[model samples]
Target chain A: MKETKKILLNSRPEGRPGDSNFKFETEQVSEPKEGEVLLKTEYVSVDPYLRGRMSDAKSYIPPFEVGKPISSLMVAEVLESKSDKLQKGDHVVGMLDWKERQVASAEELRKVDEDKAPLSAYLGILGMTGLTAYLGLTEIGKPKKGETMVVSGAAGAVGSTVGQIGKILGLKVIGIAGTDEKVEMIKNEFGFDEGINYNTTDNMTEAINKACPDGIDVYFDNVGGEISEAILFNINKFSRTVVCGAISVYNETSLPKSISVQPFLIKKSSMMQGFVISDYSDRHSEGVQQLAKWLQEGKLTYTETVREGFENIPQAFLDLFDGKNKGKMVVKV
Target chain B: MKETKKILLNSRPEGRPGDSNFKFETEQVSEPKEGEVLLKTEYVSVDPYLRGRMSDAKSYIPPFEVGKPISSLMVAEVLESKSDKLQKGDHVVGMLDWKERQVASAEELRKVDEDKAPLSAYLGILGMTGLTAYLGLTEIGKPKKGETMVVSGAAGAVGSTVGQIGKILGLKVIGIAGTDEKVEMIKNEFGFDEGINYNTTDNMTEAINKACPDGIDVYFDNVGGEISEAILFNINKFSRTVVCGAISVYNETSLPKSISVQPFLIKKSSMMQGFVISDYSDRHSEGVQQLAKWLQEGKLTYTETVREGFENIPQAFLDLFDGKNKGKMVVKV
Candidate 1:
């Protein structure tokens, strides 16, 4: 038996999640069974979407059960393998529990190349985040060349990748970020055509109008609320809005209200669609190949805000709400 | 010379439009020039969407220019024709100025067979109203057979037709209307599977949940306020909501606030699309052919609340906001 640390959901969060919501416990982990592999958790991805699972509300994915161990995408090393598919010391990624060591079925995890890209990239640009940005942009947004595209939460993992892909697709990519530094980073590093600091800007509608003189044809929305409402005013005819994530209102205890989107959508003959990454699982290989090609050409780049140690996982997740991470927030153990 | 009575948009209304916003005047109508035809207005179609054009707000169609004659779909008799395309006394239909008698280009109007259906039918079921219902539901709603479809403003022209179409397409149709009589009418007259009188219901969400026990797979929205907000909660995964109209908020002077749709949309992985009839102009003939076939096969029927006299057109248009009309509201000139 191996001693391992695992985090449990002590209680569901009312609004903003804190340390009280999580309880770290020491446990004895057993060896891998017949078709199982023993995994040592290396990198844990902490995202805003986890907040939805923390609540008991109905959602695309079921809410995390209270008093049970919390789970998310984790990159791990196969320390012991009872399956032929995975060898010892193989690095793998999958939806794994928040534990230092655990045994999982071979089918539950896919091996990743250690030399090809960083292990955490599998949780981000090379995995769910990358596929989400590409598929949502191409399939839903349906962006055309020379069309103006606006991205909300532009400095974050998905937003930055979406903007970069928009640039690659020959769209005039404009990004909206919370900070001036993030705004500059998206424009300068991510190759965005322009950026708006939503925090510093007065009258976002006016700012968006000035930034996109021809109006927005595609909007990849991550931060929905007032920013999304302002973007609605500047949408052109037949615009497509990809509703990716709403980090802004994810933690609201009560029902959040905003200007009705129905009127704006009607006026412009526009469409807004929301999707989870799993919806496009059938086309994952296609997405992975294209993303891998872009990465090889140095056309696609990514950033990571890695937090050290397994004990800090809960705090890393809480930081996502505060916008403390520059890019993908990952806890390395 | 013909003495034509024309209604001019005197001024834009702030909220609810009244007689003060329209000015009636008598004018001399000139003879049709070389490619033009002189038309005598026979039937005038007054619709809720006209309210959008009455205000100087940005919409799919431009706001009617103030101090100019407002126009809509009209069926008229060809009084005199200078072009080979039309003959005298031939009934024609087109978007024409709100004038009793006027001259228009022969190309502007299409000859309609008066013997096949009532002249007024061209302005309702055989015209824009029917096409709006067909295209909006099929193209945007994308309803799957055996799916549950809930329609708001279910007693109005588009809503009534949408519910009927949903039934024809093999969907379980539920309708929401203001009055209990309308709720009964949609179920008994329009052949909807279920009905909910939103005005009588204490909690629309619970009522909708009970009505659409399987959850709403398709929502054809015409009202788009509290009713729509209630519908949002009961949407099934991958649901499609066609935002055909938002008559409830059409007359609002200020921005209308409601529950933010982004969270619900994201949670369901659904889509909401808004479209005007003209967006599918290319598919109009297909829509008309199908509607005409259905009408002739005794599978389809329509209702029109006809108000007599040309001068009452403004009041007829105003009555739309009050839910005074059952289906299509038309005026005989």
Candidate 2:
């Protein structure tokens, strides 16, 4: 038997989660059953959506039960396999228990070839996050060449990938982030045409208009509320807005005050669509393959802000809401 | 020469338009020039969108100039014609000057065949207002059979048409109206599955839920603001919201306080689209032909709140904001 250290949800959080919300435990992992495989976690992804799952609320997916192992997207290596599809030493990515080791059925894990790109790429640019950005952009935000695309939280995993893909499609990409460094990284590293640090900007509408004088043709919204209202005012006629996340209003105790945008929407004849990555589960492989191809071609790049140890998982997850993570927040347990 | 009475915008209103904002003037009709025709206005359509055009602020259409004739969709007779496409006494429908009698270019008018429908029907059921409802429902709302479709301002022109179409498409159509009379009209006359009187309802959300137990799949919003926000909460996954109009917010001094629906949008993986009739200009003929066919088959019906005299045009237009119009408000000039 091998020892497995895991982080469990200690209690339901009302607002922002804290260290007290999680507890670490060690368990003995038994040998794999008929179709099961033992996985040694290489990297665990901590995303903004995990915060939603921590609370018992009606959402796209079910909530995490108190005292259960925190589940997340994990890139792992097969320690032992009893299935023909997966063998020992094979790298995989799947929804896995937040632990140093986990036992899951082989059907739950997708085998990954590390020879194409770095192993961590599966958790960032070529994983669910990347697929989300791709599907949201192509499926909803049908951006045209020379059109302007605006993305909020553009330094993070999904937003960063969306902006880069917009650039690849020959669109002028403008990004909004919380810090100057993230803005700079988006412009210099991710090839964004322009970036705005929402922290310093007094008027987001003016900043957006300044960055996108031709008017925003596609708005990839990650941070909703005031920023989204500002973008709505500047969008061109027949523009498409893709709502991937609303991190800004997630922690509010009461419903946030929103500016009435229906009038503007009517005038512009625009559309705003919201979607979860799972909505495109059937086409996820197509997205993954395209993103992987982009990654191998060096056309797309990703960054990870890895937190060390299973003990730091809660902190790493919390850092996402505070905009402390420069890229994808992941834990190395 | 024939006498022609016209109403012109005397000045731009600061807020809600009053009688003083318009001026009536009489002018002499001149002979038709080459490719021009003399027209006698029969029925003039009064809509809520005209209020937006009166202001200098940029909108979907150009602003109505001060001291100029307010253009509207009107059914008229060709008093004299210089173009071969039309002849004297031919009935026509076009964007014409709000005058009892005037000269219009042949290029601006389309001959209306009264054999298919009444000449006044060109300004209501088979006109821009009808097309607005038709395209907004089919293209934007995308209501599926057996889905619940909720439409606000249910007894008004666009809303009434939307509700009727919803029923024809095998949807359980629920309507929200201001008065009990209008509510009954929607349920009995328009064939809506149910109706909610927003004025009497203590909790609009509760009323909406009770009416649409299956949850709203399509929300045809004509009155935006709090009501629209409430509907957003009850929408099912992959629902579609068509923002046809926001009459409630049109005359506000400043932006109204709205509830944040972004979280719900993300949770439901839904879509909200705003459209102007002009956006479907390329498909105008398609919409008109289909609507005319429906009218002839008696599958669709329309009501006109006809306010007699050219002098009442301004008041008829303002009555739209007051929810006084039972269906399409038209002026007999």
Candidate 3:
């Protein structure tokens, strides 16, 4: 309780960032000011999007400062509260530092009901990741019953939720993942109609075509590369392609190459849209409530690949680009 | 007429096809069956989109069959009608063959009132081209007052109308064209706020940045290549890109390559949509009536590049790739 060990962005990665880019430093814990709470971190999220902030390039959100503590969604337990909104033992989620213990303003954290869902769910399935999946699919994909929906990064947290939502809406869901295990998880666990392991599929386009016999009406593209190129070919007329994340190109040192989409889009009169989750900041709770309801109804399933201890947070984050985790990749401290 | 002269698709184009791909043939005029009308072609449209139909590749519309008359929109004089819907001497527009004379069912053509607008206007402003511009802007662009709207192919039929409509909607309109003459016409005549000559501008992206001090809000992309790439860089958050046409790459035997738009679109949370005018088939009259009203009030002005004689139609169509014509290219037969 006296020491706060935080991960600092030591250096910007040239291509694929690893543990070398992060520095672990320990400091004395500070007292909570008025309207502030001292939180003991229980679970911290390591998302693919964090790779973008690791660079100094301009983006939807500013790049993380080189010397400052890397920040993301963390589920924590309030040990000391100077605010009336939260009390000791209250479980909450906040955009906090990658630290074992930290002080944050009461407004920075929101109380999470542990009785409704697990504490780690607030870092992923019932948090930003879930909202990202819901908003991108619902707002851009515009899912309709009986339509064929294809989602890339099918085994990831957002992709998993997207496929389940598609199924719940009566869509014939097909997912593209990287491994046989992920493929199996999508079909048997997430309730997708079919799954394509792009890593082993001889021809992704043919595999996708076989899975989606009726051409794809909605495509949630999370990995933008050859997989996206494959999806583009099987798109039906007026298909909606939702651009969520392109994890495939996140570590690329050069311009990412893929088949052009303009000609296909023009021929089919289709739409391709890209969005960041921050755009739906106003509708956060709507997604949370709906996701919780589905979870309570036993209609939605989620998987988490948790790495233990505060010292392993950097390795946990580095593992995301390596595709080492299933669903949400979180570190428990 | 006793004889009908037709332009036939001799062979599919192999990388920028020219007049050699067309064959002119003469045949005796056939009689109109019951519920049909015999028509004499007065004005036939030669649009850039026709270049798409010249190939056997799949698209929203069917390819022009070889050894047969190439089909497109034409304004003709109804010489005789056996149906109750039409009478002799009525001027009508319909998707008919590229011939001096032909017979079509009464339901295939809709008579146009020449008193409201010029007969040729039906092929340019008050026709499908104008509708492409209108619907693309109204439905997709969704222009707002005081926002920036940049349109490529600015002097062409659709681009010109898009810019003028942008002006009417109280938007800051910037046009991109091939020639200095077109750049001047878009500004002086069409009332565009500014114009960028892609032919003369060393850097289209820089030129666009200079023309648009405020980032682009809506981009009506008719020529999608480097120009589209340039527009992508300057897009503001939530910007809408209306993919009206990709004339720049229509003739390429290979896939078109430009900068990848995925990253930029993701960062800006923007949308890119491709649509064919025929998608609004049920709402055709709505667009036609609105365009007609704008023409009557002098709110819209159009320029047509007309070539006399059906024999010159092949060359007129070929010249589109060369950027020879100013506005809508039409043949007066």
Best by TM-score: 1
Q: What tier of docking accuracy does candidate 2 attain?
A: high
- The predicted structure with the larger lDDT, 1 or 3, is 1
- For candidate 1, give the lDDT of residue B97: 97
* Candidate 2 wrong stretches, greater than 4 Å: A1-3, B1-3
How big is the positional error of residue A288 in model 3, measured in Å on the Cα after superposition? 1.2
For candidate 2, give the DockQ.
0.85
Q: Is candidate 1 or candidate 2 better by lDDT?
A: 1
Candidate 3 TM-score to native: 0.98
lDDT of 1 by residue, A186-278 (tens): 988899999999999989999999999999999999989999999999999999999999999998999899999999999999999996898
For B149-238, candidate 2 gives per-residue lDDT tens digits of: 999989998899999988889999999999999999998888998999999999999889998999999999999988898897799999
Q: Could you estimate the TM-score for every candidate?
A: 0.99, 0.97, 0.98
Lowest-sum lDDT 10-residue window in model 1 chain B: B294-303
DockQ for model 1 equals 0.91
Which window of ten consecutive residues has the lowest lDDT sum in model 2 chain A?
Answer: A252-261
lDDT of candidate 1 over B206-280, digit per residue (tens): 999999989999999998999999999999999999998899998899999999999988999999999799999
How do these models rank on lDDT, best leading? 1, 3, 2
Local error of candidate 1 at residue B84 (angstroms): 0.8
Number of colliding residue pairs in model 2: 0
